[model samples]
Target: MNRIEKKLQSLQEKKEKAFITYITAGLPDMDHCAKLIRAQEEAGLDILELGIPFSDPAADGPVIQDASYRSILKGTNLRKCFELVDGVRKDGCELPIVFMMYYNTVLHYGLEAFAEKCAKVGVDGLIIPDLPLEEQQPLKDALAKQNATILIQLVAPVSGKRIPEILKDAKGFVYCVSSMGVTGQGASFHKEVISYLKSVKEQAQIPVMMGFGIRTAADVAPMKDIIDGAIVGSHFINLMEENQYDLDVAKAYIQTFKTELK
Candidate 1:
């Protein structure tokens, strides 16, 4: 099994929920970005969703969009992202790293080449928010050859009946989108959202993680029984931005979620 699967299995064995979070790769420059990654890992993050800064981050809200724009302005491209991962791997960072990027980034990078690089740098999984389930095959096929990185599936509240079909061949974990809109904070999951997640959990063979709008420990509390974990992005980015990109402040904030999840 890859790092993603192994990490999830380990967490399950420990009876602990996964504490996943995100960071825009190369944000505030690569050196600081790598340090923040290490800090988060040390602070008890179970999975690292390393976002590749894209010009049009359609799936993200303003916080992530602003972070992506700043990272892009700093020349953080796909190649640099790969370099960042490689650098961390060399430094012995064993956190399960998943790449969250747009389809255009994969398409332009060439699917086979992209998968090959992921294998080389030890990326455990991928999440392309904008890519439809049907169109995931070519990339899935390419990833199959590497046998290391999983093409993580996403199921939304709006997915209705299609949730089962989308997660049929899922691996790593299923990222269940908590709300209809873009990724941000102050997201509340009502009865319908919880019901939708229940349907997804029933349908999914892999562990299901709730993403989008998750910000605090309180947000994760109600979801404890419903999901295997929570994925926080915009909130984490906002922490860094609000603290002037302080790694220690970011680490302390993540520790709160980790404690809550445990």
Candidate 2:
């Protein structure tokens, strides 16, 4: 099994929920991004979703969009992201890293070449929010050849019917969007979120991780039984921005969510 699948199985055996943390690469700067990743690993995150900043990130909220813009301004591109990962690996950080990006970035890089680079750079998986299931086969084939998994997203309620098909094609873990809209914090968790997770879990053989709008530990506390993992992006990005490269604060915030899973 790949890193993500193994992580899910380990969590299942331990009767624990996985804590997945998301952060934009080169947010404040590349050095800070590396530091933040290490901090997350030290904080006990099971998975790290490294956002590859794109010029136009349609699936992201204002916070992540702004972070991407800042990262671009600071010279964080696909190639630089690979370099960042290389630096992390050179430093001996072996935690699983998933490249979270938009489809346009992949298209610009050429799918086959991108897959080769990802494999060489040690990326564990890919999460392209804009890539539809129908159009993913070629990229999937390329990544499969290199032993990398593709993580697909399932938006809530409206797309629940497509869960079985999505799961069929999904190799890593299924990212379940916690709300109807884009990535951001919501006032509260909807009752329908749990129902949607139940529907997907019934049909999904792989692990299911919920993201989008989950900001606090309390938001994650109730989800322990319904899903395999929880992904926090906007909130964690917000914390990183506020902390301004102080990885300790980021680690503490992430650890708070990790505490909730227990």
Candidate 3:
């Protein structure tokens, strides 16, 4: 098993759910981003969803969009992200790191070439939000060849009847989008959302993690039993921005969520 599988198994043994955090690569700056990545595992995060900035991120809300824009202006790219991961590994970071990016980045980087690079840099998985399930085969096959990274699938509430099909070849875990919109923190954890997650959990052979609109511990409480974990992106990016990108503040903020999960 890989880092992700081992992590989920470990959490299951401890009767604890996973707590995953998301941060944009080169956000604020490359140095700060690197520090945050290294600090995350020690902060009590089970997995790190590191986003690569894209010029057009349709799935991201205003907060992530702005953060991605700034990272781009600071010269963050796919290659830079790979370098960042490699640096952290050499520095002794053992947390599972998954890249959440658009398909264009991987395509431009070349499928086979990208898979090889991820293996070299120690990326455990890939989450391409914009890539449709119908078109995932080629990329999936490429990643399979390298046997380095697995393609993590996303399923929204509207995915309705397509849940099984989406989870068919799923590896790592299934990213269950809590709502129908882009990534943000306003949406509530209503009964409907919980029901959808339950359905997803039933169909998924791997862990099912809920993301989008989950900001606080209260948001995670309602669906805690239905999901294997919770994913927070916009809220974390907002916290870093609000605190002037202070590493301690970011680390402490993540601890609060981890405590709640425990």
Candidate 4:
């Protein structure tokens, strides 16, 4: 099994909720990004979603947009992101790394070549927001050759008829968007969103993870029973922006989520 599926199996067997932390690779700098990742692993993160900064991140909100811009200014690209993962591996960090990127970058890098590099560098999985299910087959095939999982997103309020099709195409764990809009942390988690997550969980055979608008521990606590994992991005980027590469503070902030997990 790929790292994602293995991690999910491990978590399920232990009856634990997974804490997935998201950080924009090369935000302040690649060096600092590496440090933050190490810190996250130390902070007990189950999975790390390393955001590959892009110029137009349609799925991201202002917080992640600013982070992407900052990372690009620091010369972060797909290759550098891989190097960051390599750095982590060299340091003996075993926490699964998932590359969260855009479709344009993958196309620019040449899909096959990119997948090859990811496999070579020991990447566990990928999260491409813009790549639809229909277009994922080729990429999935390439990654499968190296045993890498292609994580698919399942949007909220999707039609009941579409759930089966979406779950059929999903791998690793299904990412359920808690909100209908762009990614950002909100004050409250919608009841309807929770219901939708439950429905998706019911239909999906694989583990289901909730992302989008998950900022604080309270936002994650309620969903722990129903979802396998919680992914926090915008909020963590906001922490990085506020702290300016202080990994200790970032790690301490991430520790709050650990408290919420059952």
Badly placed stretches (over 4 Å) of model 3 are: 189-191
What does candidate 4's lDDT look like per residue over 2-79, in tens digits?
777787899899988888878888867778778888888898888999899999999888888888898899888888
Q: Which stretches in model 1 have alpha-carbon errors above 4 Å?
A: none
Residue-wise C-alpha lDDT for candidate 2, range 1-262, written one tens digit per residue: 7677777788889988888888989978888778878888888889999999988899888999998998899888888999999899889887889999988888889988998988887888888878888888888888878876555555466785676777776676788887766788653565587778888888887788888888876786666677888888888888777767688897787788888668
What is the C-alpha RMSD, rounded to one decimal, of candidate 3? Answer: 1.1
Candidate 4 Cα errors over 4 Å, as ranges = 187-191
Backbone collision tally, model 3: 0
lDDT of 1 by residue, 115-203 (tens): 99999998999999999998999999999998989999898888887887887888999999888778894675545887888888888
Query: Which ranking of candidates, highest lDDT first?
Result: 1, 3, 2, 4
Cα-based RMSD of the predictions, in order? 1.1, 1.5, 1.1, 1.6
All candidates' lDDT scores? 0.89, 0.81, 0.89, 0.81
Q: Could you tally the backbone clashes for each prediction?
A: 0, 0, 0, 0
Itemize residue pairs with steric clashes in candidate 2. none
lDDT of 4 at 260: 62
Residue pairs in clash, model 4:
none
- Worst lDDT run of 10 residues, candidate 4, spans 151-160
Residue 216 of candidate 3: its Cα lDDT? 79
